[model samples]
Target: MRLLTVLYDRGAAQLIRAWRRSLHFRVVSVTLVSSTLLVVTFSWLLASQITAAQVGSRLTEAQKQLEQGRSYLEPQFRDRGDAADPGLNGFLRYATALLVPADPTAYYVLLEPTNKDFLKAVKPQSPQIEDTRAAQDAVPADLRQTIEHSRKSAYQYVRADPDGRGERPFIVVGTTVNSAMGQYSLFYLYPLDEQVDSASSVRTTVFVAGLALVLLLALLSALITHLVVGPVRIAARTAQRLSAGLLDQRMEVRGEDDLAALATSFNQMAANLQRQINRLEEMSRLQRRFTSDVSHELRTPLTTVRMAADMLFANREDFDPLAARSAELLQAELDRFEDLLTDLLEISRYDAGFAVLDTEAVDLVPIVNRVVERLRPLADRANVELRTVVPDEPVIAEVDPRRIERVLRNLVGNAVEHGEARPVVVTLADGDGAAAVTVRDHGIGLNTGEDKLVFNRFWRADPSRARQTGGTGLGLSISLEDARLHGGWLEAWGAPQLGAQFRLTVPLRAGDRLLSSPLPLVPEDAEPRLGPIPPDEPSRGVRHAS
Candidate 1:
């Protein structure tokens, strides 16, 4: 039963797939089925009408012949006068010989009363019919009863199989004949072989014609479908070509029809899209040029300002306290400014497509550990606990160590800044062909819908809040670009007050596609709980562990 069910389901699926793939097949199949049904229904109606007409005509003819036989035999009986009583046997035999058709296509039977008590012990005689018993039995009992009970002429259709011959249709007509002798039942059987043959011929003709018509309709339907679907197929191909960067491809317009108009519109759309793309390309080229030129122009002045600020900050103890503090502030601001300019330069290099990776097989565990150790001082000041979960085995991958270190630094720093004095977990794991790192901060967390925006340049979860570390806001964006360079993935997930998790997944070898991340974006220990933090909560911090 299971195997049968599987076979049935497989068959059904194949049929459905076939039905969807070919419009021509669908159309042809439907047309053939509908035409066959119509042809069969019409043939059945025509055959029924023909059979009824043939039977009606044969019944009428049989009734007339029966009446004629009765008339001829009755007259003979009447002419015998008083001699009819004793001469009934002679009359019956004579009538039988006279009335039975010599053509062999018809037969007759004459039945007379067996008892002759009214003739003073004279035995009534009946004419012998060849195969009389078989013929009598062939007639339906209901039809015989109908004739026996009524003097009115009656007829019925029956199949006659004489002498073991195959059954053939026949019409049986019966009536009572009155004479000086007792009444007799006269029956004439007429063979309908000719009518049956004609009907068979009609059926064969109808079947052949219906089949031919169905075939013709199928051919016509296929031709029509081809004419309509040809243009659609061409349009689909041309569209595919356009999508594949063949901007100059266009459909040929042949006539002033809807299909031609559609082709015209499609070509126009392609032309318009090509123009817009060209314009956008020109604009992007100009923008990148302007950014590169501006960054280069500002570098000279920025270097001079940085030198002056450093000199003042170094000699600040010689000045008043307020002057010293101002000089320190100036140095810090200049440092932040320099960092922002450096980030902008890096972004410009990425936009100009000049960034290149110096890849090497490096263990990511030390890199992650070094980044966390470097940020331990900052984490302590922020009162945020930092935890590391690195596998003992080296997680080796082909990556640019500098870029990977920068990415990790940015992610860990961002988590510490937003940790809200809560614990932050940095995890690293290795898979079969990939390695991943996750930085999860159980901080004030992120608001709904801000997870993806966190990767955008300069995007902040809370713009009103100032950064303790003075982030340049290009960190995550540059990190994403760096991951993409290695054909890796950088993804973020967050919930309200449940902290945010940033995941970086890379292939074991540079340029290889990473199918999955070894580490989950969401921490396993995090639960869905909501409450307000108490003001008296102590600031907790943890030291880094390798």
Candidate 2:
């Protein structure tokens, strides 16, 4: 039973899904249901009216025949006066030939009334009826009571064995006649076999016609809906292919109609998109080339300036205080410029898809510690405390040590820079074929939509805020690329005044997929301050940006 219920539920779900998804199916189904209801309703009304008319005609005919029989007998009783007439038993034998004659589809009953005063000619006689006892019993008592003390005729329908056979339909009419011999009670019965047969045939015809009409309506609706839905389905498929990078894909316009206009519009939209995409592609290609070329071109001059700046700094004590300050400032700016050049070149390599991984299994514990130690001075200078939460056992994963170290340095450095004189927590945990690192800082956190923009090239959350820490603005972007290279995730979560958490999740085996992170992207305390996390971008390894 449970299995049957499951199968039924599954079938219902599939039907519902199809109904929701297919316009043609829905239109045809609605037509079929509505037409079936209408056909059934009208057919029933028509069949019932026809049956009532047939029955009414039959009743009228029976009433006329009853009147004829009454007219024929009333004069006979009047002419046979009280002194001349025999008893009702003799009268029955006399009138039996004319009134109670054999009938194939009817029965007759001649019953004596309770008041014998009416039968003045002789003693009362027992009731006599033709055919089986079932026919006599077929007369409803209420119908007989209506005729007992009245001259008017009354009629009713009943079902019984009229011919010593099984029960069949019948029409029983009761009446009374007045004459000089006295009033006599009489009844006539008629079977409705012909009327029943006619009504049944009409019902069968209506059913068959209704069924055909319903089927025809369904087919017409299906064909009509298809003419509209077919082109829409083709347009949908074409849109899908266009989105999948087939920019050349376009719908074929067949005629000068609304559907053809839709196809024309779709093709025009595709053409416009393809043109814009090609222009953007060309621009991006040039931009990458310019950056790579400029970075390489500046390296020579930068090296020559570096040597001179170093010598001038070494001999700065020999000069005055102003000269030494100039030398120090020059050296610092040069270092910053060199760092920017290096970052730009690295970005160019990533853009060119030339960056390759040099992966190996390495302990992440030492790497985390190493990054913490390197950034300790910077954190201390900013009046921020650096903290680390790591397991005693070494965290191991297959990854490039150099790239991972660079990512850790970038994350730790950013945390300290933005810690706002508060503690920076760097946590490491490993589990379930994956490892994760979370760097959290209590500071003026990101605003709405900043998390997604955080990893965008050269994006700044608060550009007006003095960046004394000298970020090149490509740190997070590079880190995201590195994570992606390892088939891992670098997700960010932040809320205004609730601080921020950056989670790095990597699979234990390089090139293997990462299902989940060992740590959450939002800190426990910050969850209430945030709304729902943004949706994951599966195309990239990064999941949600909260």
Candidate 3:
């Protein structure tokens, strides 16, 4: 039973593997089935011929023996004209002695009409000199009458001793003889058992030959199928490698068949794909350089205008109320424009694969404190309280302090804008191989399921919200990009009427990895636990505040 189970498992595994890796199974199955049908057809024809020939030979042999039996009995009756009892017995003994050795299982019986009275029939057994009345109905009446009518010779096949206890099969050949007492019938019985044995042996031989032929055909079919499907297997493997980003993969084109043409086509396709990729890469580099140049060019003029505006605003008391207000608005607008340019430039750099990280061991606690201090004035004006939580020891990380500081300041400012006069919390902590800073605000935080979209460019949870402080909506987007450049995590968690949480997790050392964030981004006061965020929402990007 265990072996049977193992066989079943092996068969199932083989089928699965063949389905996955081999195309020859289908080919082999079709070939074997066809071969099996042909072999069966041929075997059946041969079996029919063999059976026919055996039966014909048996019939021919039976005819020859019947002719010989009649010839031998003709002379015996002619010499014994009207002779009676014991002389006929002597004649029968002589005939039996002549036919015994070649086929010992032959029998002869002689019957006199009416037993010298010609009124009643008599029968005799072996070694009995006088005729007896036993076995009078041993033969069928039709056959007995035919024997009586054949005063010359007749032959028939019948059951031996039909009315006796056991019925055996034999051929009966008969002739009638006239004697001194009356006319008598002489019959000989020959067994047909040898012919049956010959027929059975012929069938057995044919069956064995058929089995061998079928097995041979199956083996040949398998080999042929394997050869035909081998190239297809190679092509499938090459296609798989090409999909896995191996642009140089090529198939061996050895023949002039369709498979070889397919291989040639695959190689050409790979070459074309590689060329397109290279062209796109070159175009991307040129675009990045153009964006950077424009950003630099704009920065110089914007800086000059900013310094001039500050100088003009310093003496604003002499100007009219309209002019003074105009000056302040110009400065604010210029600041927002500059922030947008900077983010666009950074994004171009990232797209061109030019962004690089400058790593150093710096404590995150001081960074968070500085960001909170910078945003404290804005928080107070907005009637929002700002709180900071820092660990005792230095929660050190390898990061660009300048970029990291800019990111924290953006998160804090964003919280203050939406805090709705509620307290905002900035928490920092150390974790295994990483450090995290979370900024939380108890405000009408965001639209339902818009936490991830908060970091996308120019995204707004509320479009009607005023940008009084002059913010370019690219701060969180740029921050997220910066965090990704350092292989860190910058994610948000928020809900409607609850609060918003933005967590920035950075590695402790250069190239250090993070399994998970130490602080959770989603606030505790959200209504639903988790919900799907729509990607096509109107407020689906970063909101950068300058």
Candidate 4:
């Protein structure tokens, strides 16, 4: 049943496509049908005319034979049988009878008017037609009228015989033979069933020939249309490829027609497009490499500066008041700058596609606990609660522990800074082949379009707000890159006043791709409340459930 349904669908689709594609098929079908109808009508008219002409010619010849017989027999009747010898008279009678048409059931009948008993002497077989009146009734009404008025004349057609042995169409001629005493009548009948058989054979041959001609015409029409439409189909296919970003799509030029010109123009356009794309790709590659190299070169000196600053900060008690304050500010600014540099370098590496995942089996519960503990001080300062929700069983995943910890640390710290004195939720869950972590905050949340921009480097919802949180503005971006490097996903969902949710899902195996998320990215407390996060609001900190 399934196979039959599929076949029916395919056939229906093909018929629709053919109707759309083949204008010539439609025209050929109409023309063939019309021509067939016209040919049949014309052939029938011609057959009727030809049959009438042949029947007329046969009747005229029969009439001439009858007149010749009369000329021979009239002299004998005029002489009252005085001139001809007995043998000659017998031979003349036999010759006259023999001259009557024979094949196809022809017959001659003569009625003597002088002797009423002459009909009795030569009476036809039982159920005898007494005269032409009875014979006229045997023909159709139309044929009977023609025969009744045709004295000494002939009429021909197809009709049933009076006795109904069979229907064999025939011709009939009648004439008046005047004798000494009264007027006698003579009639001749000639059948034409054999001529009808020949005509039928001719009609059959013509019908077969006409069918073959229609088939040949249809084939020729299909071939001609296919050749004309082939180039258009090719051009359409090539245009589709170009639309799909295959800029090198080109057509084969055959002749100097309109289609060939189109092909030539298309090829030139593709060549120009290909050259432009290559140049852009080369520039992009160089830019990413330059950024990567510059970051690497600056990091070595920055690390030395950071070490020297740390030494001075460690002994800041020996310095003067102004010098100590200066040292504190300088060290803090340096830390922020260092974070920015590190994020830029990581971004460069990702841009160059050189970031590789270093996977190892690690317990996710410990990693989450460590990040929360490290950020606990910051959360306390922000007056926000910190909590965690982790599974009792060890949730082991093949991930880069360093990157994972960094991502968690960034999410927790951001939530601490933005969570507006409300609770923060951190959830961990394991699945068949993957694990998920969700960080949610009842803080100032994102606007409708800010979910994607939240991960862009240096993107801030309110740039005018003070930098009290001390973030380098690239932390979220870096965290996103880190998750991606480990073949994981970091996605965010936020609404006005509804707080924000961020989910990080990673596969259990090193290179496995996650197909399902165990943790939901929308906070459970989001419904019924809607508002945008304010720029100047201070936030409650991260939460942990362990």
Candidate 5:
């Protein structure tokens, strides 16, 4: 029973989902439901109108027949003398025999005088009804009261035995026939069984026809939607393939209709996009090649320049003050230039997809400490304090130690370079099969939205402000690539003047995906309104080049 319940629930859920998602299903279902309601309303109105018309027609004919029988019968009552006359009962019986129709479903009733109580002693006041002994009981009291006083005829519907033993509905129309002898009420009991049967059959026919009409409307709606939705579905699929690098995907055009025109326009847009993408690809390829060639070509000259600069520095004490100063400046500039070349070569390798990871199980604490310790001199020169908040337990992970060290150096170096003489904190944490490192600096922090822009190659916050360490501006971009290569995340968070935090999270096992990081991207001491980034969504700060 429990399994059946679960199966029913699953099926219902799938049906509900399909109802919400499918345009064709929704359109057809709505049309069917609305059409059914309309058909029901119209069928009810039609059936009701038909029933009323039949009753009206029957009533008019019965009234006409009553008039025809009364025209000649009133004269006989005039010649029969006053209410005290003898043989009046016989006269009534004779009048009934003449007036009653040949139809078996019909009958007649005649009642005695309303006044002249003295005549009641001569004859009984009991009504005279034709054909049946108990037919007098069928005339309702309310109907008799109206007919007794009025000259014009009136009708009332009642269920009564007209022919005795069998009960059915009837329309009793009664009128007054006046003469010198007395007043008389003549009533005709008309059985409505035939009209009832006719109305019932009509309702049934209308209902069946309405049902058929609803089905036909639904079918037409489905067919129309199919013609429109079919091409739209095909266009959607073609667009998907085009986005997935199938540059030649195009829509098929048929006759010169609106749909064909739409297909032609779509094909033109796809072609234009393909051409633009091809042009961009070619330009990107040429740029990468140029960088690689330039970096390689400069190495030999850079080496020769390095050797000469080193020799000049060694012998600089014997030269004049100006000469010694120039030699020192040249050596410093040469070092900065070489670093720039190295960064460019690294970027070119990354762009060409030549960079690789060499992984092994190693403790990350040592790597963090090494990066911090190596950059301590730079921190001190910048008047910035360096701090580490690593756990006593070794955070072991499968990673390329060299690549991790490089990423750490880039993060820590940036912190110290811009720490504004404040403390730069490096916290290493591990949990949930992942290891994370956050480098935070209370410095001239990044401006709003600069957290993402900082990772772009050659991007600088204040480009005119001279860099003390002569940065090549490619560190963060390379770090982002390295993190992604390990199925990990490199993220950043910042608010203007508050501080900036850079988080690097990698899986403990090689090639494993990182679901979450051990440390938050937003620092604890930052602005209260700067909420921590959700671990599930890809942070905008990590959207650098692949």
Candidate 6:
């Protein structure tokens, strides 16, 4: 049943799509179907009326002839009486002879008394009715009963195949006649061959005419639909080209009609859109240039200030306590400022398409282990546990090690800062032409709708929270760019109070498309580590430094 429903739904959807795609097809199909139904219904009703009229007229004529034959035979019967002047056989022969017509349009049957054995046989008027028994049995039992018991006439329609000819419709009129020969049932059979032929001819003409009308209507519908849908189709194509950056694309206006007006309006809209897009492109270019220049200009001063701060910090012990403390704060702020400037410069280079990849074959397991070891001290200071799960075998990939290492440092540092004294799990795996690394932190997870925004430059998840670790807010954004440059993917998934997971997937061979990742974004062991950790319970999966 489900399969049938699916098939039915698919068929219906396809039909609807076809109808929507072609206006001409829709118009023609509807016209043909409706016209056919109308024509068929009219033809059927007309044929029924015509057949009824013809049969009624034939029945009336048969009744009149039957009455006339009775009028002519009654006197003869009365004159002959019970004396048996002309014997029963002679009377039957004379009666049949009088009723039988030369044209053979009608045949007569004479049924004698049931008790009489001598002339209890059917006598048909024409030789065409070869089977006398069949002719006698043609009269329906109910009709014959009515005729035998009453003086009133009764008639019915029946099928007859006289002389071995194909069956044709006939009317049998029956009535009882009391005479000297005894009580007899007389029936007159009338063949309606002419009426039948006329009806068939009418039906044939109606059917042909209906078919012709349907075809003509279909053709007319097609012509009208084409005239209307043709210009619309052209305009649709023009709109598609315009959206594809063909700013000059426009529809030809042929006449002063609705379609021509539509074309004019469409062209005007395209022109306006092209102007707006050009202006926006100019503005974007200027903004990128300005940002690049500013970043380049700041680097010299930042380097000079960094050198001075390094000198002062190297001699901080010789100065007063307050002075040394001040120098240390200045040096720390300068470092953060320099890092921000560098991130901005990197972003500008990316926008200007100046950044290039320096890729090489490298095992990712050692890189991940190194990043964890380097960040282990920071994690300890922040009271966050760092855990690593790497395959025993080296997971090799072609990548720019510097860029990947920077991304990993940013991710691990961010996790450690926000981990809320909880364990942060970092996992790596390689399979199916790709390698994946996932950093999962059980912390105050991302709020609703923050997953996508987290990758946006300078977009912070919480602006009010104090910074435990300095973040320029361009780390995830730059990481996403680096992943894309390697023809890979970087995605984040998170829910409130459920922690966040950042997954980076890269192809084993640089520039090779990565179809799937070996590891899932949501960790397999997530449920067990979701709640608060017990104070006395030793951390189970921690891998320190190594």
Query: Which clashing pairs does model 1 show?
Result: none
State each model's C-alpha RMSD to the native. 7.3, 4.8, 10.7, 11.1, 4.6, 6.6
State the lDDT of candidate 3 residue by residue for 1-546, as single tens digits: 999999999999998888666557765666667777876777678767775676456445544554565566556656766554567667766764443213445455556566522212222233332432223333445666876765556666666553233565566665665545557665555555565566567667766777787777777877877666767677778778877878678888888877778778878987898788778878887877888889889888988998999887777778899998888888777778887897888887777777888778888888899889988999889999999989989887889998899889888999899898999999998777878888889888667558657776788888898864566788888888888877788877666677778888888887876776676555444424545444553222232221
Q: Least accurate stretch of 10 residues (summed lDDT) in model 5?
A: 116-125
Q: How many times do residue backbones clash in model 3?
A: 10
Span of ten consecutive residues with least summed lDDT in model 4: 537-546
Off by over 4 Å in 5: 1-12, 65-85, 101-104, 113-153, 158-161, 164-168, 175-186, 527-546
Off-target runs (Cα >4 Å) in candidate 6 are 1-23, 70-83, 87-104, 114-143, 149-151, 161-167, 179-182, 528-546
Per-model TM-score, in order, reads 0.82, 0.87, 0.58, 0.61, 0.87, 0.83
Global lDDT scores for all candidate models: 0.79, 0.81, 0.71, 0.71, 0.83, 0.81
Q: At residue 286, what lDDT does model 4 achieve?
A: 89
lDDT of 4 by residue, 195-311 (tens): 677667666766677667667766776676666667777878888998798877889999998878888997898888889888998998888778778878888898898898998
Which candidate achieves the best lDDT against the true structure? 5
In candidate 2, how many Å is residue 258 off?
1.9
Q: For residues 459-484, could you state the per-residue lDDT of candidate 5 as single tens digits?
A: 98888776888778999888888888
Error of 2 at 402 (Å): 1.6
Off by over 4 Å in 3: 1-283, 527-546
Using lDDT as the measure, name the better of candidate 1 and candidate 5: 5
TM-score, model 2 to reference = 0.87
lDDT of 6 by residue, 68-137 (tens): 7778777776676664454866766767677764336677776765542222444454565556666666
> Weakest 10 consecutive residues, lDDT, candidate 6?
537-546
Which residue pairs clash in candidate 3?
Answer: 82-179, 82-180, 456-541, 456-542, 457-542, 459-541, 472-544, 473-544, 474-544, 475-544
Instruction: Tell me which of candidates 5 and 6 scores higher on lDDT.
Output: 5
